[model samples]
Target: MKSGFPSTSPFRLPPWAIRLARRQQNSMAGAADRMRFVIQLALTNVTAQTGGPFGAAVFETKTGRLIAIGVNVVEPTNCSLAHAEVVALANAHANLKQFDLSAPGMPKLTLVTSCEPCAMCYGAILWSGVRNVVCAARGSDAAAIGFDEAPKPKNWVATLEDRGISVTRDLCRDEAIAAFQRYQQTDGRIYNARKGLT
Candidate 1:
C-alpha cells in the first residue's frame, strides 16, 4: 500500500512575464513612475481578492529588482495589522532571508505604498529597514474614501527622514486616488474598527 498526495511547488512566473516585468522595472525612471507601477500591480492583485483597495511593493533601487508586491489582506486574513506595507515588508524579508534590513552596505530598498502608511505600518517600515518610502496618497486620501487611517504627527516625514529613511509623498497621487475611488464605487468593504471615531 502507498499513500498518494500532491506535491507542493514554489510559485514561478512564466518566462515571458518575468521578461516583461524586468523591462518595466528597468524603464522606471523616477520615483513617480515606479510608485505608479507598483500601485497598479497591487491594485490588480487586491482586486482579484476580497480586500480593501490598497497595495504595496518593495524594490531594490540600485539593481532595479522588483523584490515583492503586496496587496492589503487585512479583510481577507481577518487581521487588523495586515496592512499592505507590513505584508510587503514581511514578504521581502522572507525572500531575502535577512531580517537586519539596516545592516551597512545593504542594497538600497524602497517601499512604495498606494497610500500613506497607518501608524502600524509606519513602525513596521522603520523596523523593516527600508531606506526610502514613496507614497501615492496621503492618509487623508484614504480617510476620504472611508478608511480609518491612524492619526500621525504632523512631522511624520521629518521623523522618518531623521532615522535615515527618506520619505516621498504624493507620488502618482491622482492614480492612487482613482484606485480608492474605484473600490468605493464597487462597494468594497471598508474595514474601519473605529469608523465614526477616527
Candidate 2:
C-alpha cells in the first residue's frame, strides 16, 4: 500500500493484505504457526521491497504478527557492501527507538527482509538484544552472502549457525517451482519447510 513508496514504515495493510501475505506463502506450514504468533500484537508493521541488489526488509516478530521496522534498500550505485551494512545497523537502531524496546510487553523484533542480513546488521540485532529475526527473502541465485566486499563460499549458514540461531532454509531454493505449486489447496499450498508444522 502507500503507493508502494519507500518509507520508514508502510501503511497498515487491510485484512485482505494480511490474508494475501498468508496465501502467498501458504504452502509454508511453519510460517502459519509463526505468523499466528507474530500477528497478535504488532505495535508496528512494515514491508521492505529490498529484494534487489542490496536491499532487505527487517522484521521484528511479536506475539501474533511480525513488525516491519525498517528496510535496508541501499543501492549499489549509491554505496558499497560496507555502506549497506552500516545502513542496516542504523535502521535497526532507529526501529528500537520507535518501538521502545525497553518498555515492558515490548514486542519481539523480527527482521523480515528479502536477503540475509549482513554481518553488521547481525551484530546490531545481537547488540540490540533482540533474537526473533525472520528473513523473508531468498539469497542471490548465483552468489552466496558474505560480510566482505567480495562474497565467497565460506560465508554461508554456518556463519549464523555458529552464532546459535537455528537455521532453516525455505523449500523455495531446492524445490522446483512446479513442486512448490503441487501442494496447493483452498487455504493455499501446504508449505512444509523441514516439517514440524501441521
Candidate 3:
C-alpha cells in the first residue's frame, strides 16, 4: 500500500469543511477561541448533512496554528472508527508525517473538541500524543440526545493528566450544547445510541 494511505477505502472531511477550515485557519489562539471554531464545525456538519454533530481539531499549543480539523464522518464513510477526535488526530499525524505527535522538535499539540470524548476517543487521546485536550459540552449532553458515550472510568480526566496530558473541560459550554441542539433539530443520527448496554 502507498505510504500514509489506508489499506482500505479512504474517507475525508467534506469539501465545505475543507474550505471553511482554510478560511478560519490561524484565526484562533486559546481554548475558548478554539472551542468556538469546533462548535461551528459541528453545527455546520449538521446543516451540510455531512456527518454527526461533533467536531475536533489539533493545534500547536503555543502558536495556536491549526493543524487539522475533523467532523464525524462515521455514517457517510461507513466507518465506525471515524469519530471526530480520531479523525482529527489521524489527520494531524498525517500532516506532521509522523505517528507520534510529541516527537522531538515538534511543538506541543492540543486537541480541541466540541464535546467531551466518548469511551473510544478517550483511549485515542492517550495514543494521539497531544499534550493537552480542551472540550466543550459533556458526555451527559450527548446522552440527553440519545447518543451513548459508552463507559468511561470516572477518573478518566485525572488519568490523562497522570500521563502528561492536561484536560480542560466546558469551554464555551452553552454554545457547544447548541451544536447538539442543532443536530437534534436537523434529526441527526445518533449512530452509537444502543437500545441496551445490558
Candidate 4:
C-alpha cells in the first residue's frame, strides 16, 4: 500500500484527477477515497445473500455502467427508486475531486449501492456536484417505494435537476426480487433516515 493507504489500482489518478482530488479535499463531508471505500463496503454487506430481496449496485461514471452486486429480499416489494438514490450519492462521493473541471483525462467515478438513496441523500449529492448516477433496484420490475415521511415526488425531481446529476436506471428484476427474499429469509435488514424521498 502507498503511504499506509490501499492502492486504487486499475483506476490511476491522472494529472487533472489528482488536482481535482486535492480541491475536493478542501471541501465536503469526508475524504473522497474514504467515502468511496465505505460505500463499497456497505454495498458488499447488503448483497451477500444469494436470494435476498434487497440488491446492491455499482455505477461507473465514465461509462454509466450499473452493475448488480448483492441484494436484500422481500416479498416482492417496491424499492427501485431508493436504490437509485443510493447509487447516485455513493457515486458522487466517489467522484469527488480537487479540480475535475480542469482535469485532463476526464476519468469518471462510480457509485454502487443496494438501493436508491433518500431525498436528503440526493440533496447532499447535488450540493457535492456529482453530475451522473446509474442505479439498479431490488427487482427488475420493482416499483418505487414510498415512505410515510419521504419528500414529494415533485420536489425530488426538481432538486435532482438542481443538483445536475443525470440518472439512468436499469431493471434486473429476477435477481433483485431473489435478493430481497433471501435477505428476509436470512433476517437481513437495512435502515437509513434519508432512503426513499428523492
> Top model by TM-score, which number?
3
TM per prediction: 0.82, 0.41, 0.92, 0.43
lDDT of 2 by residue, 11-71 (tens): 2223433443344322222543443222221211122222122322234344333223222
Least accurate 10 contiguous residues by lDDT in model 4 = 1-10
TM-score of 4: 0.43
Candidate models: Cα lDDT each: 0.72, 0.34, 0.84, 0.36
Better of 2 and 4 by lDDT: 4
Misplaced by over 4 Å in model 1 are 1-29, 195-198
Steric clash pairs (candidate 3): none
Rate residue 86 of model 1 by lDDT.
Answer: 79
Tens-digit lDDT string for candidate 4 (1-198): 011111231122223323323333221222233234323333333454322233233334544333212222221234433333333333333433322322345444333443344454455445544455444442222332222224535556455656565654443323344444444456654443455553
Listed per model in order, the count of residue pairs whose N, CA or C atoms clash below 3 Å is 0, 22, 0, 51
lDDT of 3 by residue, 42-142 (tens): 88999999999899988888878888888899998899889899988888877777789998888899999999999999999999899999999999999
True lDDT of residue 171, candidate 2: 27
Q: Where in model 3 is the C-alpha error above 4 Å?
A: 1-10, 196-198
Ten contiguous residues with the weakest lDDT in model 3 = 1-10
Which is better, 1 or 3, measured by TM-score? Answer: 3
TM-score of 3: 0.92
